[model samples]
Target: MKLGACYVAKDNELKPLREDAYFICNKEQTLDVVDGVGGWAAKGGDVGEYARQLMANVIIAVHEEYMLKRSVDLRRVLHETYFHTKVEGSLTSCILTFKASLLHAVNVRDNGDRPDMAMELVVRVEAGDIVVLGIDGLLDNMYPTKMEEILKRETKGQAGSVCLKKVAQQGMRCTTRLTSLHSLHSLKLQKRQD
Candidate 1:
């Protein structure tokens, strides 16, 4: 399977990189995305840290699972993932894994909640299916019907890299516009907050 991934950040923003992160393991038949909620962003620390920690844990879990011959277990993997996150006391993040055509997700719960990924899910995949995983920056930009159309039309006509480029470009446009709006707010509030 071929996958494409990208993120866009404004020039010299407080956090140049957004909190959304992903991992692609073609060799292990796994794709993971983690959306970090308002952790340091709200607390005035490193705004991008929760995501990096979660992403690292997911990558290590994927590698460990890849070495085993048994079928993958999403629950077990997530349990191990929490081990990495809990060191910071709590984690406010969501995780999703796509293995082959199967989909498993653990929804985001705010800090202080139990780390229970009991939302059982199993899905079937059709031929030539392409999935777009992103944070609000990309998703808030495109409508569902439009996104489906992009996947259907592009995946059939272009290579994996080409399709991903198109999608990322579209996401970049969304974030750029969103950032402009945010910039106005940030500038206005800069003096007030201090």
Candidate 2:
């Protein structure tokens, strides 16, 4: 049974979609949700387009190859691409696979060793978990932790729409926080250099 969920959307002008998307499907008794990070398809790059094509083929291959085995291997679905002549920038993604309670995930990021900076979150998602997918325009400001708290507090038994409305109320706050974080990071980097 495919009980996994996924979401992807444009977060900024720097590659509106950033090539990240997630999906869940059954592979035998285990289920795997693959998170894909699309490469930069900037002014003269094909990362975005190629990433999508690569992912599509990979997903199909996974289903065909792993369905009978019932176990989802993260390494099997993930492969790294090296560039020789082109300046290739890659985005990061996270995938989670599970069976009843067993969970496994694969995460790839544009920023090395910084999975936390990316927007993908794979927690113990409930049947009631409200999955919100939007561009950085909406989330770049507010951190995921805050969003989770807001949703938990304001939308106990309400619908997803109501929860999202409450989240919207805090959009400005998110923007402020984003700016603050940016400033702080910059300052820290400057201090290191000094």
Q: Rate the local accuracy (lDDT) of all candidates.
A: 0.53, 0.41
Q: Which clashing pairs does model 1 show? A: none
lDDT value, candidate 1, whole model: 0.53
- lDDT of candidate 1 at residue 191, scale 0 to 100: 7
Query: What tens digits encode model 1's per-residue C-alpha lDDT throughout 1-194?
Result: 55556655546666666655667776756666555554545566443565676667778887787788655566676667666653232223334456667665554344233445334445565666665555555545544565566666656434543555566567666564332221101100000111
Which parts of model 2 are misplaced by more than 4 Å? 1-18, 26-43, 80-89, 109-139, 153-176, 179-194
| Residue-level lDDT tens digits of model 2 in 1-194 | 23433243445877675444334454443222222233233345555544455445446645755756646554454431111113333433334455464444444444343323323223454454454443333355567677677667665444443555445546754444453322111100000001
Please give the range of 10 consecutive residues that has the lowest summed lDDT in model 1. Answer: 183-192
Residue 87 Cα positional deviation in candidate 2, in Å, after optimal superposition? 12
How many backbone clashes does every candidate have? 0, 8
Residue 178's lDDT within candidate 1 is: 36
Error of 1 at 110 (Å): 2.9
My TM-score estimates for the predictions, one after another, are 0.69, 0.51
